[model samples]
Target: MTIRLAILASGRGSNLQAILDAIAAGTLDARVVGVFSDRPDAQALQRVPEALRWSRTPKSFANRAAFDAALADAVAASAPDWVVCVGYMRILGAAFVQRFHGRVLNIHPSLLPKYKGLHTHQRALEAGDAWHGASVHFVVPELDAGAVIAQARIAVEPTDDADALAARVLTVEHPLLLHVLGLATAGRLAESAGHALVDGQRLYTPLPLPLNPT
Candidate 1:
């Protein structure tokens, strides 16, 4: 059974592109039913067919909850089995989180529980962290505080700035996100009672990335 996937993105949509590439290459057995963005000008919209692309301005809404409600409605219309947030800058509301529940996934630039919010690479650099990477996790209501599915680690070079570090991390992120999605579709990855599970076993820690090359 092909998993029906919906992607919400804000920005360059590199991760979105990665998923599209994976589907095109027959690496992932899923179909992207919709690609949504809060920013009307988001480049991610370009990756999908004209009918699958959707965009709405956040400014039109009176408040955050109202905006999220509209966003949730848009996602619901697609009837996606899974909702993936890739470079989606907006913080989702509780309603939206509950709507998708365990089916909603996000790819954060940080290893997670480390830099939960934005400026992850800069913060890691300032903290003198030896390693930095990305994590694929469930999207809970409290920021990025959710059970991680998998992570990709990379050593931080001595002279690396935020941009340089982000570039390296992104290279791993593209493949890592696809790998996690593959697991989800294969029934090897899941969440139960708020805990992440792999092959019906509880996942105490997130699975490490590069399990297989993209």
Candidate 2:
């Protein structure tokens, strides 16, 4: 069966595009059934075909629950097997988290368990960390605290700032998202023994120094 996917984004659709490209090239067995955003002007929404359903609801719908309900409704209409958050900036409520459970995935710009929230690049530079990168993980109620699936790290160069590092990290993020999604769509990724197991093998918990470009 082809994997049906719903992608949520709040900014440019670079990550969304990566998934689309993967599917187009037959590297991933997934199809984007829907695209959604909180901001109607989000560029990602434009990437979806006119035939596919896309929505942008009020950010302050009755409340967070109402917003989640609206978002869930849009997602369910697509009948997707997975909901992937590329650059979505909302803090999903617990109810929404339980509804999706293991079927939801998210990509964070920084190696998780390190910088859970925003300003990650700045935080990394401020802390003087040698390496910084991205993570693909299951979406839980906690902010970027879910069980990690995979991570791609890049060295933080001396001249790196938020914008420079973010751009570099995004390069790694695009492919990492596709790789993790491919595993998920193939039913080869799962949580086991506090780590993500793929094809009966444990994926590395985090990317280490002397980072690889992939």
Candidate 3:
């Protein structure tokens, strides 16, 4: 059975586009039932067909929980088997996370457990780290502190700025996101004994890619 999916986002959605492309190409067995955005002008919303009931309104809700409740309602209405958060900037409430539980997946633009918060590329470049990457993890209540599903790391280039590094990391992110989504859709991705398991094996931490000449 195909995994029914809802996507949430708050910005320009390169990750969202990657998922859509993967679905279109039959690499992932899923259906994007709904696309919801907290921002009215989020570019991700434009990718959906007009006939689909996509939403971009959140100002009407009174509070954060209320917003989450409404958001949850929107997602439930779609009846998705799982939800994927790609570039979704909102810190979802505990209630929301619990409601979805193992059904929610998130993509972060960092190696994770290291740069769990923000400014990842810039921070990596500034800190002079050897590797920079993106991660896919299950969404839990505590920040990015969730079981990691998969990660793809690229070596930090010698002459890299934030923009240059982000661009490079994105290349790995696109494929890695698709692979995770495909695994989830196939029910091959699961959390067992506090570890994220793909095909019954623990996911490796941050497989670093070799830096290329720019």
Top lDDT model: 1
Clashing pairs in 1: none
For all candidates in order, the CA lDDT equals: 0.90, 0.83, 0.81
Candidate 3 lDDT over 1-214, as tens digits, reads 7888898988888888887888888888888888888887888888888554455456787778898998898898889888888888888899998888778888898888888887889989878899888888888888898888778888887989999998988898888888777777777888665578777787666333344333
Error of 2 at 144 (Å): 0.5
lDDT of 2 at 46: 86
**After superposition on all CA atoms, what RMSD does each candidate show versus the true structure?**
2.0, 2.4, 2.2
Error of 1 at 178 (Å): 0.6
> In model 2, where do residues sit more than 4 Å from their true spots?
192-195, 200-210
- List, in order, the clash count of every candidate structure: 0, 0, 0
**Candidate 1 all-Cα RMSD:** 2.0
TM-score of 2: 0.91
For model 2, what is the alpha-carbon lDDT of residue 76? 83
Better of 1 and 2 by TM-score: 1
Candidates, ranked, lDDT: 1, 2, 3
Which pairs clash in model 2?
none
TM-score winner, 1 or 3: 1
